[model samples]
Target chain A: MDVETLALVQQLYGAQSHYIDEGHAREWAATFTPDGEFHSPSYPAPVAGTEALTKFAADFARQDGVTRHVLTNVHVTPAAGGLTVRAYLQIVRTLPGGPPELLRQTTITDDLVRHAGTWRIRRRTVRRDDMKENR
Target chain B: MDVETLALVQQLYGAQSHYIDEGHAREWAATFTPDGEFHSPSYPAPVAGTEALTKFAADFARQDGVTRHVLTNVHVTPAAGGLTVRAYLQIVRTLPGGPPELLRQTTITDDLVRHAGTWRIRRRTVRRDDMKENR
Candidate 1:
């Protein structure tokens, strides 16, 4: 029954990892719903809507240094209006000839909804492992 | 159709985190098959079989500190004779009055098989985020 759902979920993660890691921010943002929310400790507040997401992706692409965001351990559970997905994310940053540094380790939880037979993230909350203050 | 399979995978991770964090070394080892193998950069070689796994867990449980092994982002895919599961793991350690420190961030991959109506890990691999040497 949920075989297809799980596959769809896999696609979501696959596309997300590929696009973001490869610096296709708009394409990565497109994996979310039009009004999807991306929240993290680095941000002052959640970035919402396609317009904001576009700008957010642009800013991310402008950051200095090479980064690879590795997403793993994706667990998806059916929810009332959609599905809840949780996974662990690690970002590695590197300079020329230098070993990769651990930039951030975060747990990401996403609320996904199937709209028009396509699964899209509705909200993504990122919780950093080394957060100093509670929000 | 695969809902239960994924849930069982989630259970494997949940049980692993709980048992290891709470110091139930033997119980944690039971999550693996009789001939299961656990490998990590920290280990000189793969810890093979239940006996070795038991000893490894025992030594881990003796470490001093309040530690939490937080597992997230679990992706489970069907494979020959079993399932391949991957996720991100973060270990947090805290001393009294000190901030929770990120001790380790690793990407874990486990090969699990269903035996006699139960799922058990066959081979588990750990890759750390900030390893200076490649193995």
Candidate 2:
């Protein structure tokens, strides 16, 4: 991938992280396409569509406190649709009366489309690894 | 990073994925540097060094079945010592009596160095998102 594409992917990741951390569920949901699919290995079913995703985010926001989502090892490939990006993420969640928990260690596989010149998630599947009990 | 570097990163991901899925734990563990640290957010402590990582992988190999790990959105930047790469991954694991599980969706952050002219992971950290119970 070129530098520009890499930068754009990073920007999209940053936006998603910001929305999630800031408790802007609606905005976070808007990061995807109208008929987007958000798949997480932990979830029984894939969260489909922008509206549904928005609602899910809203509910998730009711949790105790802040979270820091770190993205690394981002790989982007040019595709007919737009860009296929894969990233490994580390999410640290700090809740009330507890220390920050290393919530997940997994990879994000996503198909992003450029809508009006901005990258948005068209399909996302999250794979989780090493699920351990918190101390 | 240039094409050569990007290709190298992809190769590394493929190697790790192959070893993990095929139960070649010791070989998989050798992909890292001697003092390497494998950090998964879900784990309380990072898996350190080549030997320890090998043992850990060997144990993990006793699990059920085959897995397909897909890597996308790979971004690589030139670092002082070697290269830093970030990628999102989707790992699909299929066991004997169950359907394929999207094991994890996360980002992989790693520092890689050229040892004997070949890239090896010096350190790696995995972050996960959206944990849902499997059906």
The C-alpha lDDT values of all candidates are: 0.77, 0.74
The true-versus-predicted C-alpha distance at residue A50 of model 2, in Å, is: 1.7
Tens digits of lDDT, candidate 1, A4-81: 788678756855764564467788888889999999987898999887887787777666554557777789998889
Off by over 4 Å in 2: A130-135, B1-135
- Count residue pairs with overlapping backbones in model 2: 50
Evaluate model 1 with DockQ and give the value: 0.09
Give the interface RMSD of each candidate: 5.5, 8.8
DockQ, candidate no. 2: 0.07
| Candidate 2 residue B78 C-alpha distance from true site, Å | 9.0
Mark the regions of model 1 whose C-alpha exceeds 4 Å error after superposition: A1-118, A122-135, B132-135
Per-residue lDDT of candidate 2, residues A62-96 (tens digit): 87787777665555767887988876666678988
Give the lDDT of residue B126 in candidate 1: 87
Candidate 1 contains a number of clashing pairs equal to 11
